[model samples]
Target: MTIRQRLNKQSICILMLILLMMIVTACKSDSENVEQGINDLEADSEQLNPSEEEEGPFIPEGKVQSPFNGKWIPKEAANKRPIALQINNSLAAYPQSGIAQADILYETLAEGNITRLMAVFHVYDSEKIGPIRSARHYFLDMAANHDAVYMHYGGSPQAYSYIQQTKAPNLDGLSWLDGIVCWRDPERRAIPRMLEHSVYTNQKHLEDGWERRELRKELKENFSSGLEFVKEGEEIIPWGQRADYVTVPFSASYTSSFDFDAETKKYVKYQSGNYHLDEEINEPLMFTNLILQRTKIHLIPGDTEGRREVAVIGSGTGYFISSGRAVAIEWQKSNHGTATEYIEKKSGKPIQLNPGKTYIGILPQNLEVSFQKKAINQ
Candidate 1:
């Protein structure tokens, strides 16, 4: 217990004190980090709670009824009333009795609330008429087999026209949801006297006819002009002078789903070549590959009153005819003259759609998309 021993003890005490102070500082730093994290979490919570102004897609009070409520159609609900009323009302400039071709389409459409559907029509070549002898294929096969959003079929104008002639089960009389023959009209669009025909069942006639050369160039340059010829409230117009007519049903919706540059490499839904990554990702229900819906709009022959003819436009191909624009979940390779490509449902103004062969998916209502690994958990 001399001076050296005393000095050693003092050094040990100082070392212990230093270690204790270091421990306290570390604890304080960890505590501060935890508190900051808690505060950040609280801020996020406050931001997410919907404000008075925001309203999500909450199912309203009372049991809502539509044709698309459950899985497939319930038996009792079959043979439901004709939806021609819904179709006619939607297309007429203002409701009118002249649109009397109701109750002709189908027997039962599930329920009074049937809102969604997957309609498949046959496409027959113009020359053939018999069902089996018909090309016996589906138009928009690429779309129907997969998603089923588009109002697609595989057949010729002859097939559809033949269907009209035979009065098929639920799809005989001309309604807005049926397929049409894409015929051309010279006076229809202001092209020329001889070159005014469309390419429905007369491809051979068109090619051989003197009008074909001029019309081909015109169609290539202005195939979209047909869309413009259709006035704001113009119902379905007749096909040239024939009793038959070309139709544009309001049953189709078009949209593309592609975003290769995204880090996730998923099919970006709703957003096309236009949305910013941050905006789409941050938005509610934002994801890729979800099916979009569309309404079916049919163009048909117009009733003539002397020189002025009146066409009927109906939209009863009920697919998500719910809160917003109806949902259209598929796109066909051949959508040149379809309604979904040319007009917006809410405004009826023409929208710039993806040209060429592209998958067209649409949700009629203003929709926000979400991703589900499997079917979305209820």
Candidate 2:
């Protein structure tokens, strides 16, 4: 063959080889895309958002802003029977600071007209009972007389997690009487075990301090991105307590059972209240009013500590005077101890009854009253 003919033939063969390679590559790419599409279809529903597929109940968006706006009545006209006391001297004997005042109030209130009272304390880092005991015993003694007692704390979840895993000695004191917990905040706290669906932090962990930031992180890392949380409920089953009744900010749709989708790492809210083996179950959290005065009871909002704030609602469940027409004896704080006491102080005077305007600062000691009666006049 001539040189020009040979060159032309070589170019034709090369062109055919290139065409065959392009066809093979195109087929491989098409197959990959088809398989990917099918996997994507099976991974999630057709909708772009998983939240849209979520069908059950969810946390609310806002806190209870206004409580007891029109609910309160004037003190003078309030049905002032004796204060219902839940805390007493037996439960709170440490400080003796408010004991005198508590005795005076107890003596003054007529029999059958007294309230059952309880006291609470908030101690930071209650690691060991040294200086903290001064505060702890005081409240414990005060709460001795009330219907119930509570102690609150706010701490990093890491510390809590360590306690939970190790089961420290101090933890034994708090694991079961009325416990209330707020989820740890994610910004500052971490809870790894709670990431699963329906798994409850062991009840042995009812210690009061719950960092809010840690809870958010655990939930976000485990759940979807759009999950929004508000104060779900005030009645958190702290690592060790129980309540006679629990109220929620919103009613829960899931009652008890839980199933986890391991592939998606999603917690499926179950409707039954039983925790099944190999299933993660979470307790329904109770939403508490941040301002506290908006609660069912008409009193100031306060934490487990003696530090008081101006609240239009009651902090937790306790004795309250709604409309100032009913004298419901509830728990209050005192200067002496951490438990509830029944003593009320008005410029050193034993308050015969809890008026609608009882200043939490002056409330003598956490006192408990036994029997309470509404004024017959009302």
TM-score of 2: 0.21
- Residue-wise C-alpha lDDT for candidate 2, range 227-301, written one tens digit per residue: 112222211111212222212111122122122223422222211232211111123211111101122212223
The reply for model 2, stretches above 4 Å from the true place, is 1-11, 27-31, 34-38, 41-86, 90-378
| C-alpha lDDT of all candidate models, in order | 0.26, 0.25
TM-score of each: 0.22, 0.21
- Candidate 1, residue 328: Cα displacement in angstroms equals 10
Q: After superposition, how far is residue 98 of candidate 2 from its true place, in Å?
A: 22
Q: Give the range where candidate 1 is weakest over 10 consecutive residues by summed lDDT.
A: 101-110
**Shift in Å, residue 218, candidate 2:** 40
Summarize candidate 1's per-residue lDDT along 91-188 as a digit string, tens digits.
Answer: 11111121111111111111121111122211111231111111111222212222112221233354355335532222221233222322323242
